[model samples]
Target: MDVDVLIVGAGPTGLALGIDLARRGVDALVVERGETLAPGSRGKGLQPRTLEVYEDLGVLDEILAAGGAYPVGMIWTDGEQVGRHAMFDPAEDGEEGSRFTGPWMVPQWRNQEILLARLRELGGTVAFGREVVRIGQNAEGVTAHFASGAPVRARYAVAADGGRSAVRRALGIPMAGETLDPDRALVADVRIPELERTWWHVFPPSGPDSGFLALCPLAGTDQFQLVARLSAGAEPDLSPEGVRKLVAERTHLAPEAVTELLWASDFRPRAALADRLREGRVFLAGDAAHVHSPAGGQGLNTSVQDAYNLGWKLGAVLGGRAPEALLDTYEEERRPVAEHVLGLSTAILRAEARRGAATRQLGLNYRHSSLSEETRRDPGPLSAGDRVPDLTVDGVRLFDRLKGPDWTLLTLDSGVFLVRPDGYVGWAGDTEDGLGTYRARVGLG
Candidate 1:
C-alpha cells in the first residue's frame, strides 16, 4: 500500500483527519486538486463544539490567536444607520461548561492553513494537484486513480473533496437534498477603506421582491466579506467594478470607496446529504457526506467534527489495536447528526428557528449508537455517548487529563467513566465490572 490511509482532499476535514492520524503514527496522505490551499473567508464561524475539537488537536492557541468575536450587526436604511442587531443569541447561564460559550470568527482559509501547518508539524504529507479520477475497493484494500499521478493504494480511503465530490460521483452515491432559496447569492472578500470595521453593516431590502446586502469585517484581516442576495434570474457579476457598483448602490459608500476585490463567488443556498457515508473500504466525510446552507454556520463545523470522529477510529484499526468493525460506527454516528444539522441549517435560513444551544452543537450525543454502554442501573445527568464536560477534578482540569490520543479512564465520586479519544463517554459504570468487556470490544484490552 502506498499509505495506510488515502485522504482525497486537503480542506479542513481532510487536513484535520491527517493531523489526527499523523499524531497516532498512521501513514496517511492527503491529496488536493488545487495547487494551493483554498482562499477566501468562506464559512468563517467556528462553533463552540469545534473549538473544543481544535483544543484536543493542539491548535486551539493558534485558532484563538487568529480570530475574533462576531461584531454587532448595524442595520442601515436610506444610507443611514437605523438600529443595532445582535448577530447571535447570548449563551445561557449553565452552557458555560466548556471554555467557549459562543462561535469564534476565523476565516475558513485561515482555519485550513492552521490545520495544514499542524499536520505538517506532526510529519503528515499532503500531495497537491493530485485529483482523483476513480476509486475501487476490495477485501484487502482500496485503490484510487488520479487525473495525472500514479494511482494510490491504501488500507482505506476517504472522500473529503467538496459538495460536488468527484469521488462520490465515481462511487455512484446519490446525494439527496433540496434548494432552500431560489435567488442566487454572491459572496466576496473586499477592502472598503471608507467602511468602519466595528460592525457587520446590514442593508435590508428597500422594497418587496428586492434583496438584502451585508458587509462583515473579517476577524483577522482587513478585508470585509460582502454577501448580497440577488433577485430571481439576476445575473451575478463577480468583477471588481461590478461588486463596487453593487455596494455603492446598496449603501452610502461610493464605488471608489471599494479599494480592492480579493475574491468572490456565487451560489444558491441548499441542503443535502449523501445516501450513505460508507461503501466498503471507501468513506465519505465533510461536504461529500452532507451539505448545508451557510446561514447557521453549521456546515464547516460539522465537517471538521466528522474528521475528528473518524480520525481515531482509523488510527486504532490501522494500528491493529481495534477491530475493523469499529469503522462501521462512523457512518452510523455521523449520518443522523448530519441529517439533523442539515434540517437546522435549512430552518435557520428560512427563519423557522433561532440559533441557540442547538447551533453550538455541544449537546450532540451518540446514545443510540451500539458503542455507548450504560451499565449503571440508574444513570445521572451525564450518560454514555454524551460529551464529558471539562471539570476541575482535584485541581486538575479534566480536559488536561484527556489531552492525548488514548482513551481515558476517568473516575469520579459518582462513578467510573471511559472517555473516547473524541471526548465522548463510551462506557460508564459504578465499578469496573462491565468496563473490561467494553474495553475488549473497543480494543483497549
Candidate 2:
C-alpha cells in the first residue's frame, strides 16, 4: 500500500485526522485540492469539546494564543444601542471540570493553519493540488485517481472533501437531509474602520423583505465576519460595492467604515447526512458525511470529532493491534451522533431550539454504542461511553494522562475504568475480569 490511509481535503477535519494518525505512528497522507489552506473565517467558533481534543493533540497553546472568548453581542436599532445579548448560555467556570469556559473565537483559516503545523510537527504529509476525481476499491485496498497525478493506492481512503464530495458520489454513497434554510446567506470577512472589536454587532430584520445582519469581530484578527440573511429569492452580491452598500443600508454603519473585503461567498443553509458513513474500504468524514446549518456552530466541531473518533481505530487496525471489524464502530458511533447534531443545528437555525445546553455539545454521549461495555454493577457520575471529565489526580491533570495515542486505565473507588484513546470510558467494571477480553476485542492487546 502506498500509505496506510489517504485523507482527501485539508480542512480542519482532514488536518485533524492527519495529526491524530501521525501522532499514533500511522503512515497517512492528507491531500488538498486547493493550493493552500482554506481562506476566510468560515468555521470560526471552536466548541469547548473541540478545544479539549486540540489540547490532546498538542496544539492547544497555539490555538489559545491565537483566539479569544466569544464577546457579548450588541444589538442596534435605528443606529441606537438597544441591548447586549449573550451569544450562548454562559458556561460557568470549570464546567464539567474542563479548563476552557466556552467556545473560542478563531478564524477557520487560522485554525487550519495551526492544525497543519501540528501535523507537520508530527511528521505527517500533505500533498496540495492533488484532487481525487475518481476512486476504485477492491477487497485489498482503494486506489484514488487524481486530477493529474498518478493513482494513489492505500489500504483505506477517507472523504473529508466537503458537502459536494466527489469521493462519496464516486462511491455512490447518498446523503439524505432537507434544506434547513432556503434563504441565501452572504458571509464575508472585512475590516471595519474604528469599529468596536469587543462586541458582536447585530441588526434585526426591519421590514417584510429585510432579514437579520450580524457582524462579529473575528478574535485575533482585524477582520469581522459579516453574516446577512437575504430574502428567499434574493441573490447575494459578493462584490466589494455590494457588501459595503448592504452594510450601509442595513445598519447604522457608513459605507466608508467597511475598509476591505477579504473574502466573500453565499450559500443556503441545509442539513444532510450520508445514508451510510462507510462503503467498503472508503469512509466518509466531516462535511462529506454530514452538513449542518451554522446556527449552533456544530458543523465544524462535529466534523473534527468525526476525525477524533476514527483516528485511533484506524491506527489500531492498521498497526495489527486490532481486527478489521473494530473499524465498523466508526460508523455505528458517529452516524447517530451526526444525525442528532443535524437535528440540533437545524432546530437552532429555525429558532425552534434555544442556543444553550444542546449547542454546547457537552451532553453528547455514546453509552448505547456496542463498543461501550459497562460491567460495573453501579457507576457514579461517569459511565461507560461517557467522556472522562477532567480531574486533578496527584496534581496531574486527567487530560495530560489521556494525551497521546493510548487507552488509559483509571482506578477509583467505583472500580477500574478503561478509557478509550478518544477519551470516552470504553469499559467499566469492579475488577479486571473483562479487561483482557475487551482489549483483545479492540486489538489493544
lDDT of each: 0.92, 0.91
Residue 344, candidate 1: Cα error in Å is 0.9
The residue-by-residue lDDT of candidate 1 on 71-147, one tens digit each, is: 99999999889999987886854465787778999998999999999999999989999989989999999999988
Q: What TM-score would you give candidate 1 relative to the actual structure? A: 0.98
Model 2 clashes, total count: 2
lDDT assessment of candidate 1: 0.92
RMSD of candidate 2 to the truth, in angstroms, is: 1.0
